[model samples]
Target: MTSFLERARSDIGTAPIAALNVGARRFSAHRDHAVEAFPAMDDMRDRAREIRLHTLANLDRYLAQFADTLEAAGGDVFFAADAREANDYVVQLARARGVQHIVKSKSMLTEELRLNDALEAEGMEVVETDLGELIVQLAKDRPSHIIAPVLHKTRFEVGALFEEKLGVPYTDDPIELNSIARRHLRPLFLTADMGISGVNVAVAQTGSICIVTNEGNGRLTTTAPRIHVAMLGAERLVPSIGDMSVILEVLARSATGQKLSVYTNVLTGPRRPGEPDGPDELHVVIVDNGRSKVLEGQGSEILACIRCGACLNVCPVYRTVGGHAYGSTYPGPVGSVLTPALFDLDEWSDLPYASTLCGACLEVCPVRIDIPRLLLGQRRLSVQTRTGPMWMRRPLRAYASAATHPRRFRALLRIGAAIGRLFRSGWILRLPWRGAAWTQGRDLQTPAKSFHRRWKGRNRGS
Candidate 1:
């Protein structure tokens, strides 16, 4: 199985950031925004963490209550056991309606389940409504950041993508570029047969799904279409609207440094006869995918994540490789635990190790998830499964044996030091096979001979 980093290295390099007009400086802007947003992000993350932790600790009551509230409000709710099951439920609904077009607001869970691909396979044209997501979709690319899909790209790059893909007059100016996207997506909103949205927070008491965005596109997508299908991870649940308010406070602040997003939409069932705008049919697909496994395991905190991208901004590894390097829709420290815990472990085993075990992600996490702790635990599991390089096993086994027999370990170290003195230098003269992978991008500076050996020789000469 390939490590997550290795896979990321391959995919992110190849994926489109700024196809034509977009430039690499998209990453620099993301860094600037993150720094500017830090204060609010911190406060929001703390609030979000507390709310999720509180809810998770008492999940059963909340889940049952939330389901009841949604149904009572006239919304149809379907709980799916996994990704395929969730897609099947949505597909079945879409097919039953005999509609093909789908316009979706940005939702990472949708990407995780590859919902657009599934819908497209059945001949539906899935339109992305978020600006950044729209850019990536136009470029035929995957998202690179949690909040900003095209974070690794710049305005000029987006301008280029628009020129080539959208066939518009080419200009890299931000306002013109945004206007172009707005024009492009305008028709799809009205023409789409159904709207698909990702729920940000699910209120257990009222059975409402709250979606926040800067653009009003979310409202349009949920309203214009006759049928609206909302796909949400099961973790979105909160016991009450009041609790949702707290999470929302943190969510907006952490995600964009705003006290609140430009739009915070709370939608219950379908539109009542008197309602001005809303779908006639509202179907909520509560997707468990692999989330239940986390709920049942040591990863319950990971589910506490509200999809805020604060962790991404604060992560060093993320800063270096950007989101694509994680090779999962979710990136940064959050991806380290989430991708593996929710998906294939063997395929994603390297994600946890991609970190320097830095606490930046945790520090910025709205829900204050112990990300580094969880990442290390996942790493241990990977090692136990022998999912990584073979050489790790040899030293690990030797270390274990050493701990069991102290004297033997000491003697081995002494002997090794004696040998090291013969060819010791700042740079490694020779390396054991196990250490070769380390030399790929670095020169390992060798340690000096044991101080005790040098001391004994000096005393005899004196």
Candidate 2:
């Protein structure tokens, strides 16, 4: 199999730069609008960070409180230790309930767990309701971005996909495409036996699951089906309604720049006796799936992420290569840290080096997660554990040795300059040994004189 970096290189050609450019422009405009809408945005972010830190510190207490409160409200709470357990529990529940169809909203956790495949393996029809998700599902493609699953697709491509898959007449008109999708999904929403969603924030105070979306699909997914199941990472908890409000205030601004998503559903339990509409049965699955392991270490700060996708939008690497390039469910800076920390460090060691340590992700994060710091930590751990590529070890050691000694560094630079002089065009097209890999797609511009030598000469002349 190709490595993540290799795959990313292959995917850059397929990623629609025009679509990405438009999306970036819209994202910037919305973020600006959000900043103008909320004068206390900084304070809200600070409060949100504090709340997340406090909740994570006492996560056990909040989780227990949330489960107790949820059970008291007549909702069943299941604690899944991993993806298999979570998928099995849901599958068993579906089997017992004789569920034939499942209507799902946009839920990255379900994607992470590959729940759709698991359910389909058990012979159940699964439909994605979110517009972006539906597009990807119909095209049989993975989401290219967290917030905008099909951000890499153009309207024309989508029209073509609809024509090919849904047997609809090809038209790039957004309204007509939406109308076609709605016509197809409305019946699924009405007849599906179960609804599955991912929680944006789980409030411990009221034991309510809050999900934010720009479409009515979230509400329809939860309310229209007889059985509703909300899956959440254990770290998605907030201490109170106030904290949730604080986080919510920043989430929309950072995510898509809206003051609030068009629909924010806070479902506490199944339909109450006197309620006009809701699922007859509600289930909340709290998944650990290596999150508890992440909490026990230095990268625990990553658990504070609100999944706003602001990091993805601002990350130069993500923007250039797209989300599919990351080769993880959660892509971008957050994924760079979380994938290695939660999964195999040896396998995902390259992910840590995928960033330029730009710090833009940390600055844009709604909850103020120190993503660059965590990424640095992962890189350090990779070095200390010798989990990174073996070829890098010798070069890094030589660089470190030479860097610590002035005379050796100066000699190395003089030698490097001499080697540069040997090249006619002043560009080293290929380097020897491990450096060859670095120069494969990049040309090294060898300066005529080292910076140190130039600085000394200037000082003498002055």
Candidate 3:
């Protein structure tokens, strides 16, 4: 398999990278404007953070309350320990119900579980109802970003994809593209036997799970199908409706700068007596999938992420390489901390190093996750475990030694300055040995005189 860095390097100046840059910048600007417009933004963010941390701390109690409430309201709750258990529960439910077609409403949890592949293996046709998800599904591509699944693709690329996949005339117009998707998905929604969605925030008090979306697919997916299975992460819960509302206040503004999403559906359970449109059976798969381990570990606060994708919009690395480069279900600054914390650190050690430690993600995060601190923690863990890049070890060891001793540091600085002065151009075209990678893209500047030398010279004259 290709490495994360390799994938990122390959897409540097590609069309997808260009598209990602434009979309991320637009979303970042909108979020800034939205935050500026909201008078209580800072206070709301503080409240949201408090709510998130509080809920996580008491997650066990809330999960039990939520399950009991939902189960009493004619819904079933399955606590899955991992991906296999989660997929098996959903597949078994489909089999028992004789479900032939499943329409999904952009559930990242399902993506993480690779639910579609599992269902397809069981001989069921699963369709993505969200427009971005539908486009990626049709193109047989994975989601690049959390909120905007196809952030890497431009309209022209989407048009081409639709034309080839749906046999429609190629049109780069977004309106026409949406129309094509709507026409194609309407029949599927009506025909699908099951609907799967990811929960934004679940209210333990009312047993209601919120699904925020920009399109009507969320509603259709939940209502049109006879069975609605919500793939909910265990951490995505609030103590009450008020807590859920507080999270909603920041989610949309941080995500797309909207006061609220176009469709914020709160479903308590299956259709009640005389309900007009809703599924007959409601299943909530409370997937743990390493979350329990995460909750017990150093990076537990990462579970507080609401999947707003605001951090991705502001991250310089994410903006340049897009989501595919991260090579995980989640990407960007949050992903750098999350993927490693939730999975094997040895495999994902490179992710934490991808950042510039600029703290842009924290600045834009609605819940104030302090992603940079988490990232540094991950990097520290990687080195402690000896799972980080082997090449960096020697250099960092040397740095540590020199930095701890003032005399050695000064001597190294003098040597560096002497080497720098050897080049009259004031720029090193390439560094020796392993450092060639550093100057490959741009030349390294010559080092100026050390501060110690300047201070000493001025003092001598005095």
lDDT of each: 0.79, 0.90, 0.92
lDDT of model number 2: 0.90
Worst 10 residues of 2 by lDDT: 13-22
| TM-score list, all predictions | 0.86, 0.92, 0.95
- Best by the lDDT measure: 3
Over 1-462, each residue of candidate 3 has an lDDT whose tens digit, in order, gives 566788888988898888888999999999999999999999999999999999999999999999999998999999999999999999999999999998999899999899999999999999888999998898888888889999889899999998999999999999999999999989999889999999999999999999999999999999999999999999999999999989999999999999999999999989999988899999999999999999998889999999999999989899888899999999999999989988898998889998999999999999999999999998899899988865566789889999999999989887887887798888899888868978988898887666887799789957
Q: Compose the digit string of candidate 2's lDDT tens values, residues 215-274.
A: 889999999999999999999999899889888899899999988899998989899998
Comparing 1 with 3 on TM-score, the higher-scoring candidate is 3
Task: For residues 349-448, write the lDDT of model 1, one tens digit per residue.
Answer: 6677888886877765668889999988998888878884443567788888987898988898877776666664667644667567567656777566
RMSD of 3: 2.0
Q: What count of clashes does model 3 give? A: 0
Q: Judge candidate 3 at residue 95 and give its lDDT.
A: 97
Q: Rank the candidates by lDDT, best first.
A: 3, 2, 1
Worst lDDT window (10 residues) for model 1?
17-26
